[model samples]
Target: MTASSSAQTPGKKDALAGREDAYNGFLIDLEGLPSSPEALLASLRASEAVWRERAYRGIWLRLPKRLAGSTGAAVEAGFEFHHAEKEYLMLTRWMVEGQPDALPPNASHQVGIGACVVNEHGKILAVRELYGPLRGTGVWKLPTGLVHVGEDITETAEREVLEETGVRARFAGVLGVRQAHNVAFGKSDMFFLVALTPEPGQTELRPQLEELEGACWMDPAELTEQPHFVKRPLFQSMLRACRDWAEGRPAALHQRKITSDDEQRRDLILLRSTGGEDGEL
Candidate 1:
């Protein structure tokens, strides 16, 4: 798969499906994995021999959660744990003699987007979840969700808001971002507070029945009066920041598409703070 080499597939059809990687390595497909541990071990050995003959640099093996019992066979083949996702575990082996492992780290942080829909009248779109940290608390908060694979923050805001509240909103800009550790799936998360303006005449409420207890247009003052918001000064500060965003005191980040003449990094979309004073940017 490297620039100089031809397709380096296995010499014969083995029990496991394998393909070449861009780095002159082999990646074993996770689907149709052998159910029998003995068969899996034999397949790995055959694939390894083929790659070894071609002087491949490394081998990547993925095992689905259902095939976890076959892990011993992969370990016997000299594979070590690289990382794991919600659905599968990744294993790797260095193939070239004396060449150290040179794989990039797997993704470590998840991005979650929250929609803060402020209308012309300044009422915020809010929902009460049937689960999570605020379940049954009767606290009205922004409709939020995790960003899907290959989805941008702007799309995520519109999709989540429409899903949770049936409100088709216009994506304005980003309000803020919050980072916390040891969150969902034992990974760190970056929660975005996205600013949105509800469609002028389409703000009808249709709360998601399964996951949400209620959804409505809430006055900003009403959020401060919720019992859950009363005792926690931190949440209060968060909402206060939202209020500031609605009033246009603190300029939000605006989205801009940037392209470079360099082919390797062209057409990248970036979110820049409205005020250029952010030295960190």
Candidate 2:
């Protein structure tokens, strides 16, 4: 992957180099001081028009270095970082205080889970699918699902696993946040890797053929053999999480409102969704 010009800074470069060696690995700790809620909220109002109707894919999209510096009021106000690819980054619109909601409009209200399953040998669990969204469907993927309304994300994972494969398990730590852009879906989703362990006597694991065309268990080494696995965001995220867990690392949790700062303010300013347009704002 080509490193972007901005990633050349000493700090960014060092981090990128370390991440490369790890091969798509990095620790993002979102647990820190929160930003000023009101000032941040106000700024979102003033900048709403600028961020609308733009699909910017990099850090430069947030604000040029000319108008803003490496450190700005935005960063101090709880800036969030989204890793689109190895070198690309996107800053989230809200501070830590009001999160999970800070996501973009298209990205809002999304929740998915990944099982950090491990076997008797202490190796993390993974599955190779003979069918599904992947190219040949012979790809490794973490058993995951979308959280339904009122259902918890964790519960969705467990229920999906049982419904799709019939395995009961528990989760421990978070793997990492995965970002993927799908033209087909016309949206982006963040997948959370969760550490999970099957309950005792729950060893009989197999994909319900009716639900899934085919599925099988695989470890790190075996996972690499099947190239198709890398194509899936969930699988790729799971693999990265497994490797991180193997090395005792934690996935970064950068929570941002799915809505752009401006949209959020617009929502607040207008305070309601009108069925009809108001000509132009």
Candidate 3:
């Protein structure tokens, strides 16, 4: 039988089903960059079943096209690309470092995006970001920006906060790091959860039209039910931060789920109700 047909045959079905379970289990234990199937395979080399599947199929099992598109030789080639990439990383690591664990670090170098903490009172000294992918959007997000070369993360945070929010705030402590995979941008963003110590009163927030359309602070919980929440990881982190702050478990904060489509529509309404122009246009 052909390999495709064999996968559907009764005898092979049972083995493949078991393999599917094992594949998931292997993925859970892998640590390398999983942006691509080949990267995943290289990191999961200890599994013999996975290796055999790759050999029999002549490709990596986790090829994206195999999961998404029509079955064809090209689809199979997509799998092979991943397989070859995995093989290359494996051989290079084995020869150079003598073990996968000895391989060089690949921690992503991130462009710094600033962090801001809205207090228990639900006030955020935010920036009006005017020109970027998110420009002309009425959603007021926490003041954030990329770190220039030679700038420390904390220094970058402090600078961006003051520049964007118009408040001289002190660093409180780290909240946690948040990351999201952007398939459209072909990059992942790492958002640092930072605490900012600000003055007790409402500060005059300004809008740099070059960077923002508008800037202001509204209730954080209000956005939880809105659509703009989908665009702001800072807002999600704020919820966890508030929870931890309330519970006196500041260091125990965990990342929250990304906002859903339903929530986004609600936020759009909330922002528009404020006499703010529609953020989505």
Candidate 4:
């Protein structure tokens, strides 16, 4: 008999009955399964017989957030936690007795950065994307982009601001962090908020034709009052923080420096202990 034919058992019916030939194993879709530990344990035990009979390669168990309580029972049945998202968790049980090359790969989170630039006039710099989820939706947001490899997060914010809107800005500090799971393209995304101060003598607004349709400096009051901005929690939170900073309230931002292996220390010259010019730390 062929390998596929040999893997099938006769006169046995379980979760693996119909799908045996397709996936070469059983998949316990625990979406609507009972959340009780006892029920989960029973289900896992019943699948073990089919696993041994078929000599299956692997068994997958998907656990939604609602059934999180069944995790212990799954672990007890030799299932290991694999990956998780905001909605569900994935676990795997290897039926084969030998070692495998590597464990199942988990999803990676993508890091993004947004620049929140506020000029001396207390107006916030915003952009309207030429194409995106909010394209032509009258939704104007802060200039944001993904952090490129080997680039500092703060520097990424500065670059994105300049690219989308022709505005030179000095990095002030971080404002906050935002995270979302299973975002566009089934990937988890993270955003870092970088505050910036506009450089002197640069005030013209020029939007990048490729990504942005319009770019301009918006008054903080007008920004908060916009119907579109009111619906987004991120923008609302940023408006509050900007208002506080404008009122002389100190920003709760921490300063950080980007360093690399090839970074060189600044040169220093010292006269004496009593009268010294400078010395590098």
Candidate 5:
């Protein structure tokens, strides 16, 4: 296998050369390399020495799918698997000692919420987006948006529905959870399925023209017949679950009781006795 290197300081031949984009260290791109464990071991050992001598912060070794066989070598050499996709596997090793055992505290997963709003007539609220990855695909989906800081998941669902369809609904409970890797801009995403019902007076549909082409209530039969919707079995399943919930079926509780700072400490003690600590009954 052949290996090539790039650095912030072009003329410098040191592998551990400092660089602004290297997270205070260097990066080794190992794409399109042959799957040879021996060659990978040799490269990793050499890189480790350079990192120690230069006192770099960290090093990232990116291995494409073709070189996936070399992953064992990387791990043995103290590189942790950061993330992976169908195209590549990313691994990183910190040169500094005493790093935390877990991922950096700042590492986070993107949280999103999808509102499954159904009316008393057994019709579900759906919207067509004016622009997105699935725009013009004729796919109608529930209103969804990212969860902002200090915002609850249920509140996010309600806000997204109001902003996209101009319909205010009450949160019922959680329907399900969906996790996808490398979904949005290479970040892992967690989507909560929140159930909602129309409030006493809010039944009118007013689509947000900037993001939605149209908003309407669709019957279950129509949803099943739609070609695009039929292609997505998960949407069909969620619709059925939401409909059941609207018809008085029970759902998992997603809401929690609010408590004062002093009460919060006591609540933690109670939770420990109720199997919350070990996640058992």
Candidate 6:
């Protein structure tokens, strides 16, 4: 990263060492920051003036919790709270006139995916979690898991089913989606109900003991035997939807190759369908 030309401030060399981003915004480095709030404020003022003179669009700066006391310095320099973390706070300022902020906002949604894996016998694959609210409730649920960063939903669905039930399955397509708020870490969640075909001879029991009490190819009717399972309308609907796909309805889910964040890549797979009833495969 390159610092401003006048960054050599006699004693504090490169006190405002930051580099311009692609959009002409300056991103301040956390290292070599000014020591005290007063010093910080002075450095910020100097940097702001230099950036403005150089036609930089905005400034993005992050301060660790230890230096949170210096937040006043940044605020005094017209920086606004962009977002925050337990360990740090980010502040941003728009230096240009009549243009929108170029930086993207913080992430707000979490995604989870599960698979409805059925065997030739037509029983759905399910698992009983070792600890969550369903531990000993006799409620068998489709093995579901949160999507890891950058993980494809299909990959998450297939992996979760295999990890929880030891069933090798191939991603078929999505069945439906269940959305809820105030879940894990208090974030909103999008749960993708997916359908997977069991790989040949891949049906067996090998429950992951750490996260599951047991796993089985459960008859859909057996779920009703558990009083707790009957009340879960979401799972009930998922069962219905999966059966629809199995019973010769057009696949409700189909994969489309979409462009990834990088403009040059068009191989990211997205699962979509024709509403809830039927879709063209």
> How many steric overlaps are in each model, in order?
0, 13, 12, 0, 0, 0
lDDT of 2 at 133: 66
What lDDT score goes with residue 166 in model 4?
90
Give the number of the best model, judged by lDDT. 1
Q: Which lDDT tens digits does candidate 5 get at residues 154-202?
A: 7788899999998999776677788889886677888888888888767
C-alpha lDDT (0 to 100) for residue 23 of candidate 6: 70
State each model's CA lDDT, in order.
Answer: 0.78, 0.48, 0.46, 0.71, 0.70, 0.76
lDDT string, candidate 2, 36-94, tens digits: 43443344333333323222221122333333343345465445554333343345543
lDDT of 6 by residue, 51-167 (tens): 766787778888999899999999998999988979999999988778777666776679998677877777788788878787777677788888997788888888888778778
Which parts of model 5 have CA positions greater than 4 angstroms off? 1-105, 260-281
Q: Write the per-residue lDDT of candidate 3 for residues 23-81, one digit (tens) a residue.
A: 21211211222445443444334333443544332222332432233223323323222
What candidate 4 gets wrong by more than 4 Å, as runs, is 1-107, 258-281
Which consecutive 10 residues in model 2 have the weakest lDDT in total? 12-21
Model 1, 1-281: lDDT tens digits are 22323443466667355667677777776665788888889888877667777677888888888989988999998999988888988898887677678865677789988888888778888899999988877778989999898788888999999999898997776777889999866889998888888887866799999999999887888876788887888678778877876666543677664556575543424456756543434
Task: Judge candidate 5 at residue 107 and give its lDDT.
Answer: 38
- Give every collision pair in model 5: none
RMSD of each: 5.1, 21.3, 17.2, 14.3, 12.0, 5.6
Which segments of candidate 3 are over 4 A away from where they belong? 1-107, 119-122, 181-187, 199-202, 230-238, 242-281
Query: In candidate 4, what are the lDDT values of residues 29-131, reduced to their tens digit?
Result: 4443656878777767766876787676777677888888889988998889877878988888877777682434675778898787888777889888988
Error of 6 at 176 (Å): 0.8
The predicted structure with the larger lDDT, 2 or 5, is 5
- lDDT against true structure, model 4: 0.71
Model 2 lDDT vs. the true structure? 0.48
TM-score per candidate, chains pooled: 0.74, 0.45, 0.44, 0.55, 0.57, 0.74
